[model samples]
Target: TNTPQPKRADRSKVYMADLESALHYSLRVEAARAAALSGAQLDAFKCYVATLVKYFPGRSCVQTYLQSLDTWLRNWTEPELPRSILKEAMKNNRDASHPAVLPTNVTWVGCQGSEPHFRGYPCGLWTVFHLLTVQAAQNGPDKELPLEVLNTMRCYVRHFFGCQECAQHFEAMADESMDRVASREEAVLWLWSHHNEVNARLAGGDTEDPNFPKLQWPPPDMCPQCHKEEWGVHAWDEQAVFTFLKAHFSPTNIYLDYTE
Candidate 1:
């Protein structure tokens, strides 16, 4: 008998998929090991965790994972520790088990990473940020909630994101305009515009993946109503984009296709 082929992953929507989560955890371990070798880097990682716990305590699943991660970071300070031992500790200490802590309804959203060096951590990180902002908006009527999430993300990118130049660009953007986000709606749009700006800048640049060119997201195909042509120049209807972003990042739209 012939073996059945696996289903192809849907590429259009950002998925909460396992492949990138695995990459994310692997990178975290690698970063931890590297940070342990350097005092400055280790300080940065510790700050990242502290900020996570401080800003996201309301998010129960994330908080549990952060607690585990904080414990591991504190316990594994010795740079001379063997990699084998470190890996074992991570396994035994429950340090890399975010999925287990996540809510049952929470499904993995896999983003495009058809090949190496394509959209990986950056995509997943943005997805998580977007989700957090949406959740913040939905969790209450506090207008400042979304801004809180955005600022926490700003700090994360500033101190711990692997790409230093990318981090600098994001931090500059936040410093310049994040204050203009006066309401939860503005906060959502702010991140969407920031992502689009990054896409526009990186398009056709060295970081552009040939197979998955960076275009203004929610492209005509995904959300045609969100786009408009004014005086023969393409533009977005802010209202439409706002509506689309909320729904796109909302838990209701999350698919469980590749989730366990």
Candidate 2:
């Protein structure tokens, strides 16, 4: 038989030790960076770093650590550098060493000078939401919302709204709005406004009441077919739309499609 073997290491303990070691390594790296920079410049860097820490804490408090590095930078330099120089240095450092940290899902859109029908369509909301979905998806597979929710929303847009095109447009708009929204309240308000507008027209009245207005009796254009076909389609009437939007939009379906 062979000589006795040394004791085996505990797997959990090893994992914890590895994690602590990595954290220490990161701290050391940041400390080294800070050691090179100056004070006022460090403050500016801290502001940026803090923002990153607040919104996108992917794996750890990288932002705060970065801020500390900024502080170190402030105290390390001779006569201290200007804030601008610090900013430039930080930017260059990030570009070289942390290229993946930059924003990836932001975009701009304008309908002006575009086709008339599509020009005033207000597609910003859709674009934003689409970006939000992409960001959420990239964060992790588990973070992604259910596809069925999107499907349900699409179905609602198709049936009750009468125009698949508008529905599609709205879906994208909703997504965009969600992405750009600063808070949950804003998102709720946006959906509510859209719902109320549709309801007021459908109910045949002004903007005060939340429910859909009664169909304008005798119809504005006097085209009975048009009145029946186009007026008062609620965006979330379909089960799919209703369900998918319920989480993000609103739970209660209080408004009607017509004014009267």
Candidate 3:
């Protein structure tokens, strides 16, 4: 008899399952400490807390989960318990909380790829930021609010993201031009443009999934008006791109498929 294959998530749409999986993985990695963290790691933990508190639509369960984790992290070292005691306390805190819920209104089609090594974490994470930026823009009359999302994302990636070189590169990019973003709308566009640039740079690199090659996203087929030929060079119509992104990342686009 042949062994059974695991059922794969739907590749055509972003499943809530994958996004929650990614978030859970991040929380475990960031919090799995057997000893007290160094100063830098502590700062990273602080950033993680800010990322949760900054506000986004939906996912009330996730907000509660992070809040509980933050409570434990803050109280940690008050009495400096033995390592075994501390570990048990952390375990109890996590167990008391509800299961991790997917972030609000985030989706990426490639999350389920032909090969297991392709798209998973990066895709899920980008969807989260994209959803967050869009939601921040929606909730904004405060021009500074949207940029808060961008900055929090930068800090989270700089400190918590496992890929050090990738984190440094993202930090450099944010440092280079993020200050120039002046309005809520501009913050949304800035992230989309930079995401495209990263896609362009990695298009044919070893990490590129041959089955789903990276492209300047929202290709012509997806949004014809977003692209154009200028002096025989490809370019995007900023207004169209902005419109597409706002609609694409909106809550209505989120799918509950494959979710618990």
Best by TM-score: 3
Candidate 2 stretches greater than 4 Å from native? 1-94, 100-126, 129-235, 242-260
lDDT tens per residue, model 2, 1-260: 69877334321111222222222322233222443334543333343333223222232233444554445554544665454454444331333343322211222122121233331122323322322232233343432333322333333343333355656666775665545544333343345445444434435333222321233222324322322223666233233332233332221221111111
Model 3: per-residue Cα lDDT at residue 191:
91
Considering only N, C-alpha and C atoms within 3 Å, which residue pairs clash in candidate 3? none
TM-score of each: 0.72, 0.22, 0.78
1-260 per-residue lDDT for model 3 (tens digits)? 59876455543344555556566656554444336544655556555565655544445666665666567667765534344543443342234347533343333344866677778777777877877777777776746655777887887787678777878879889999999988878888999989988998899998898977998888888889999989999988999988888888776766665554
Which of 2 and 3 is the better model by lDDT?
3
Looking at model 2, report the run of 10 residues with the lowest lDDT sum.
251-260
Candidate 1: regions farther than 4 A off = 18-27, 30-109
Worst 10 residues of 3 by lDDT: 86-95
Candidate 1: tens digits of C-alpha lDDT, residues 1-260: 59877566565454555423633453354344442334555555555555445433233444565666667778776645444554444442234445314322322336545676777667777776776666666664666454777776776676567788998999899999998888777777889889999999999997777877999888898899999999999999999987887787765565556654
Task: Report the number of backbone clashes for model 2.
Answer: 39
lDDT for residue 20 in candidate 2, whole number 0-100: 23
- Please identify model 3 stretches exceeding 4 Å from their true place: 1-13, 30-35, 38-40, 70-110
Cα displacement (angstroms), candidate 3, residue 244, comes to 1.3
